[model samples]
Target: MEMGAENKVGTIKPEGEIYTCPTCGYTDGFHVSFSALKNNRKAEVFLICPNCHNRFRLGWHVDLSNT
Candidate 1:
């Protein structure tokens, strides 16, 4: 699966906090992309800034197996 390719999800509210965009320094809205893997046990994430439309790789694995 592609990490930050055309595979993307959008307009979802982020869980913890909204972050600032490194590319444009905008801090209000964001889009999210999650690539599911390992039979839905794990996922890769992408955070996109709406202001600049810049995509940021959230280089960590989400362990959905916990829940």
Candidate 2:
């Protein structure tokens, strides 16, 4: 999968949380791209569901201390 420049606003190492795709009811994993804001207080997440091939966006809270 190719991610465009606009889609990649930031990179976070996969560590803190495991996300589930709501659209296709997928829990195993996701094709994830994300951008953090407010000094890592929040994040804008873009996810592609592997099972349904559907794209979705999410506003997530970043837990800086977790990692």
Candidate 3:
């Protein structure tokens, strides 16, 4: 199987601010940030699931405290 348009975001479990992968439900993964939004307040990251190796393009709400 390869990554294509079919590999998109679906169901996401609302378990606090921690965002999990919608495809494999993995709690942890590698993130690659490409773009920023809202004056660098938020960012778009390529989240790769370690469990299933599924890649997801998701919007990440930048944490102000972390900045």
Candidate 4:
């Protein structure tokens, strides 16, 4: 499907840091960032399984230190 400006960051941000199960297929949005979340400095990618209602978070480090 086509991606909009809000969904162009390559990550899905939900209201609360609640993610579904990755084992199940469920193409829906999930929460990644929360309050005082300093550990995750990079962008987290949430991918829902199409077959089962599963949610997976891909934590990436946006190393701007080199820049």
Candidate 5:
């Protein structure tokens, strides 16, 4: 029985959204992806702070379509 990290399955898709941290100019593309299946069954976007290397997750969804 080998349960490795690579065996993890993600259901989320990256919509190419960039979020800027207020504390710093850390701009990281927030990829829309799935995490924690049971208690947390919601999709989230993550942004890594370049300055402080802090990981930020925006728990909100926004339509980036022109329409």
Candidate 6:
């Protein structure tokens, strides 16, 4: 099958955050970034699974430093 631009692995952001792909059950290789509410205690992230090329939006709490 021919993969389109959405499926092609282009320039990925250099971040170490890992996420699991719900579509293909891949546990590695995902492009993740904070989408909104970054200043708040909770935030949302945009993810693109490299294994299955599926996109996901997830909300999570931020880990604040005690310092």
Q: Evaluated with lDDT, which candidate comes out highest?
A: 1
Better of 1 and 2 by TM-score: 1
Which order, best to worst by lDDT? 1, 2, 6, 3, 5, 4
Q: Model 1, 34-53: lDDT tens per residue?
A: 76776668887777787877
Q: What is each predicted model's overall lDDT from 0 to 1? A: 0.64, 0.58, 0.52, 0.39, 0.42, 0.54
Worst lDDT 10-window in candidate 1:
6-15
Would you estimate the TM-scores of all the predictions?
0.53, 0.38, 0.37, 0.27, 0.33, 0.41
lDDT of 2 by residue, 1-67 (tens): 4445555333334456656655556788777665565655556676667787565554455554555
RMSD of each: 6.8, 8.2, 5.9, 9.7, 10.5, 9.9
On TM-score, who's better, 3 or 4? 3
Q: Where does candidate 5 have its weakest 10-residue lDDT segment?
A: 1-10
lDDT of 4 at 43: 41
Query: Model 6 residue 1 lDDT?
Result: 20
Ordered from best to worst TM-score, the candidate numbers read 1, 6, 2, 3, 5, 4
lDDT of 6: 0.54
Candidate 6: where are CA atoms >4 Å away? 1-18, 33-44, 60-67
Off by over 4 Å in 2: 1-18, 34-45, 60-67
Report the number of clashing residue pairs per model. 0, 0, 0, 11, 0, 0
Q: Write one digit per residue (lDDT tens) for candidate 4, span 1-67.
A: 2222333333334445534443443435343332223564444344544454234445533432334
Query: What is the TM-score of candidate 6?
Result: 0.41
Clashing pairs in 1: none
Q: Which lDDT value does model 1 have at 24? A: 72
Candidate 5 Cα errors over 4 Å, as ranges: 1-19, 27-34, 39-42, 61-67
Steric clash pairs (candidate 2): none
Worst 10 residues of 4 by lDDT: 1-10
Per-residue error for 1 in candidate 1, Å, reads 16
